[model samples]
Target: MPAYTPPLADFTFLVKDWLKIDALYQSLGLEEFDAELALEVIEQGGKFATDVVAPLNREGDEQGCKLSNGQVVTPDGFAAAYQSYVDNGWNAMLGDIEYGGQGLPYSMAVPVHEMLNSANLSWRLTTMLTESAVLAVTKHASDELKAQYLEKLVSGQWTGTMNLTEPQAGSDLSLLSTKAEPNDDGSYKITGSKIFITAGDHDWTENIVHMVLARLPDAPAGVKGISLFLVPKFLLNDNGNPGERNALAPSALEKKMGIKASPTCVMNFDGAKGWLVGEPHCGLACMFTMMNDARFQVGLEGLGASEASFQGALTYARERLQSRAPQGVQQPDDKADAIVYQPDIARMLLTQKALTEGNRALAMLYAKYMDIAHNSSDEAHDNAEAILQFLTPICKAFMTDTGLESTSLGIQIFGGHGYIREWGMEQLMRDVRIAMLYEGTNGIQSLDLIGRKLTRDRGDMLGITRNAFAELVAGMASGEAQQHASALLDEWYQTSLQVKAFSAVDAAGGACDYLAYSGYCLLGVLWYSMADCAAQGDNPVLAAGKQKTCDFYIQRLLPRTAAHKAALLESADTLLAVEGSEFDYL
Candidate 1:
């Protein structure tokens, strides 16, 4: 495994040059969070991730988590690292100031999280879920509930978990069987078992706040009847501190392939005291506030792992002596030239670089919209919201899908070394593998994009993407950027309209391919913008790298959209024609 050096330069390029954070803050009335401050945060976060958290990655994986009795014990040094994470105020960076948070824009937290995820993903999982939980509680919880939980949660004195899955229900909440009975003291007694809960039980904090989804008695059946509840590991006492243990505990720990350091628990809540976060039957809506944030963060999870694997593979490729280059013997003094001289290796590395960097830009841009949606009072706020809703699925699905690709490329670059755990490439693959499945699987996300975002809005949201590309094309100085942007925009408009006209079955069948097409197109436009910025910037080396990567993306990867588009145009009849029993040859 190679040492994790945060991609500080790329982060700076995106935040400072491409996105123009300073100007953005001024426009959005967030004067306190300038580009300079953002850079400072990234630098310090990188240091913490490298110095404190990274060294524990391999050890944590080897040791994993230990479950004895009803409690879960994290790897050695995890608790201390988490405490340092709290002491350094990393946890509260994006929390509201009213909740003892610094009240910074969520964009500022993006790079820091990426660094953390790169350095040590297992340790980062708990914190990631905690932040998502905080968002849900902040948005929907009552004032009294906020007063009790916000301070500790924002301060990182306690952790959080999202408990939504059960034995019978996964992505489909309509099948949920958990019961929340109303109590006399205005609380609800929650009873049911929830599975696949991330960081469900941990020792890093004194208490864990679980945002659970359950059904209320007398409520309508199905997803509409589901309600959100705040179930704590420990009930609060008069002093506002953890006191009695709640009637909830981890019944079993999931034995997983990766992220072993993070506890994925089967939690059983037996008559646990909980309070409703929102109106009855509105739980799914409230939970989306958390799920949406988690989905984006999950996308970042894939990006981070991809980055780590890329760094390791690149390091190995450069130093490891191998056969001579096809062109010539680059390292005559050695037994053979380094594998870095191989053209195929270059392709793999460049592919990883383009995907990782492009996704970084996409994620950061999405974060900026999040800021605008939160801070602005004008039409920009509404537009930002629309864009966020429209891009959420793309960010989650595309980034992770490509993330898996990038990580697998890392393994291929490493050859046999990548297949083993010693090089860390396999672990990276295993860890990111789950991202495409959880937080609403990539399949689910694609359906949401084409269904809720497109059909529900009558393709109105398609204009957001179209308009953005048009604006980029109008401002682009380089001929290449203009050409690519223009062509992609035209195709995007046509494909979007075609998909919008798709019958429900056709749309459902084509959703995944459409999402892939959208992702590739979106990245193409963003790559052009990044290349344009770098081309006009002061750094020659960075400019050259960006230009070449952009060229690779445009020439090589952009062709993928054609295949996806073709698949999208295909009807579902072929798929539906196949009888279920006809495939039972096995």
Candidate 2:
């Protein structure tokens, strides 16, 4: 296994120096959170992730999950690790205070989650899904439902899963066939199968709460008929304990390419006892609450994988000697200098660093906005919510895309060794590939960004983000950093106009390119903000490194926006001109 170390320094820089989360907490009246408390949580969370959780990562991957007679068994050490995670109260870190939780701000939870993901992504999936489920239930479920399930889930005594994907219905929930018939006791009998259900069946928790999407008999067709139901693995007894088994079981575990330890189960719900969560036919809206949260978490998965890959590649490059440096040998006594001296190797490493760091900054900023959106009472709340809506898809798609690239670059850095299992770089690459596919694919995210967010709102969200970026640019010193920000803002404004115009013609054809363009521009803004923060800080070395990374992103990576913009602006006819049957000639 690759030695995993949480990037505490980076977290400190982001939360403390760059974003100054203390001010955010004060503004939002999050009295329990301060810089000291936040750092302490991060430090302790890092230890748990590194000591207990990370050790299970390689073991889980090698052993995977086992199924026997409908019962799914996790790999050795996993159950124990999960117990430890629960014992430490990590699961309840961000839960509601009314429900036996610490009620920490989401911004404080961001670093902790990043560390957990970095340590063991497969293990982290269970926790991530459960957290999302908790949010959905809290937001939409009735008081009675909350009284029954919230406390246990918040306490980590029970786990949760979101069941949205059926074999026939992946992204298109409108075609779902799950059936929910009204029962005499005012409950519902849910009978259907859901595929790719992460943590669907695990031995770690006594009861698994499945937030399922199904249809009523008398309901309207398509998505309008769908309803959200809370179906547990064990039906609650009169005393509210898990009594009789619900008519739900894991039919099979997916033999996937990566994250083997995380059980991707095909769940069969046969007349399972369940209760409606939100209103009938409004399940899609309720489910979006969960999906949106999961999307941001998935984006962090990409950031986490990239950080892990970078760590592995950086360690290997510094130790593996190859040829002399172009200038001179830094280590003259050795047979050859380390590969870190090579320009191309440096390029790959720096690119990974730039993307990972910039993504981290953006993710943290997004989390801060989430805190404001959820907790703040000021006039900024509306703007914060809008920005969060706008950035969620970009964060989900762009971060994961860069994660895949960074992990692949790790393989390149390791050459032959990276291809093999011993180095552990290959696992990072394989595991991160799914982040783009699940929780709404990157293509789906692109369409959401262009068709719904940008076009439907007449660039209102984009205008909000642009104004914010403009303010940031205006505050900066008049130099290269300010100039880069100005140029990016100009390009962003012009491209938004072009995409809005072009999307009117063919929304689907230009959506992906437009999203890519917006993603790069957003990252550029983040990089400049980081540079600006560093320049004002007292730490000279850290400031210098941040400046260099910012310059690299501006010079090398940000220019990719041009290609995406051009593609977005091109007439859809270029793509539509190629008929479906013409490819048969190949």
Candidate 3:
């Protein structure tokens, strides 16, 4: 296969032309964010992905994480590469400046993350989990706690892990049984086991900081009683050096199907000494602060893997010889034409391209939301925050779902080569599968969209998306950009209205239940809005690709909304009344 290009031109078109991220940065009052810097960052990220990380992906997956004398050793080049990442200050891309970070907008960090993940997801997982820890501390940890531990985490000197899942509680925090008892001075002694902890215990860093969830001795039942604790593998003394060893240890490493390079450990917190990150009984809410950021990051991971796979598959499709062109039969003199010459093959390739391009645009749009939500000085900040809250689950669930599907298509595009591990296409597939499962599973994401985000806000979220789309359309109605953006907006508006009607009906199920099946409609509106945003760009091939993908999504992808409409309004009976066991007969 040919060396991978980062699709910089496409990225440029999306950020500079289509999304007009400059406008967003200006809205956020971020003076440092601009076209030149963005291009430089993305170009550097691409180089890092293709050169340093991509080479190690296969090696990491094959070597996996080795268990030795209770120490989890990562693959070769991984620890050095992680240090390189920290030296480059990549982990603190959007972290707090007070903690020695760059404090870039999440928008700026979003695509940078995509490029990094695309280059090599396994290696990037460590950096990503580290950022999540930074978020947790930045939001909830105290000045004293931050002063003691924040610098190392932000600098990536010490890695971090979220200890939420136990043997019984995967997604349900209510089922958690971890315990914390008060110490004389205010610290707590934590005891319990956490399962599926990513980067839990590794030799990569001198110390590991675990953001653990546990119940106090006198705590009430369920989530409200839960508290967040900063439990490090090795305690930090006043001088910030590794002190007495903490009791937290990896009882065992999991054998997951993918991203084998990053260790997933079942942690044993044996009366481990820990400090509360935020106030007790308020941990879950504070943790929500990090969850949204982590969810969006997961979406980018899926997008990156899909893109890398597509790039590999596209190269293979264009060069590999296959059948002759249909019937003028112009390739009669040659042995055969490349597979790219086939219409069906072209359709599949175009589909992957369409989703990849659209997915990137959508990711940046969500990041743009993040930039404004955090940095904006205007009153519009609240509105932007609402929009981000509303759309985040969609971004996390929808983009990743499309990303996984696109990668599967990328594999199919490679046909035989896609299935073989030697071609490296299968590794991308294995790596991306986890995106749908982690940072909140897609099913839970759907429930969040319909149950919490859409209805609980009393259509505030609906209003935000509707108003934004209206303004985007209204901007082009009299502007010079109308020629390119007008029709797209009109179609999007009509669809949005249809979605409202589709959601408004109190079907046999509740409103939340209605949208569980109809969340895809909400996504249709979002995807089309992004497609419209992409339509405004200048570079013709890139713009044409955007326009084509936008149109194809509407024509090909949006029609699923019709079925959703049917399912939401008229078919509720068929849905719930269906025989549960008959449908699942053994």
Q: Across residues 451-566, which tens digit of lDDT does each residue of candidate 1 receive?
A: 98986676667887577567767777888668868888788888888788889999999999999999999899989888998988899999999999999999999999989999
Candidate 3, pairs of clashing residues? none
Show where candidate 2 strays beyond 4 Å.
477-480
Cα lDDT computed for each candidate against the true fold: 0.91, 0.90, 0.76
Residue pairs in collision within model 2? none
| Candidate 1 clashing pairs, residues 3+ apart or interchain | none
TM-score of each: 0.98, 0.98, 0.91
When sorted by TM-score, best at the front, the candidate numbers are: 1, 2, 3
lDDT of 3 at 554: 58
Say which candidate scores most in lDDT: 1
| lDDT tens readout by residue for model 3, 1-586 | 2256788887776677656778767756776788778888888877877887778888888999987888899999999888887888887777688888888767567777888888788888878888888989988899988998898899899988888998899889989999999999889999999998899988789999999999998778889998999999998777888999998789889998898988999999999999998988887887777778789888888788778877887888878778786744545667888888887777777777766766676677677777777876466787888888777776777777778887788788888878988888888888889988888898788667655665455677767865765565555423543443445445444543444443422322433333333334444444555555555555566546655666676577656655655554453445556686878884
Report the number of clashing residue pairs per model.
0, 0, 0
- Candidate 2 on 1-586: residue-level lDDT in tens? 7899988888888889877878878878887789888888999999999999988888788999988999899999998999999998999998998999888888789989988888999999999999999999999999999999999999899999999999899999889999999999989999999999999998999999999999999879988888999999999988889999999999999999999999999999999999999999899999999999999999999999999999999999999999899979789899999999999999999999999998898889888888888896666888888889999999999999999999999999999999999788999999999999999999999999887888788788888777767776786764777887888888888778666765455778888888888888988988898888888988888889999998899899988987887787777887877776796866
- The window of 10 residues in a row where model 1 has the poorest summed lDDT is 465-474
Best by TM-score: 1
- Ranked candidates (lDDT, high to low): 1, 2, 3
Which of candidates 1 and 3 is the stronger one according to lDDT?
A: 1
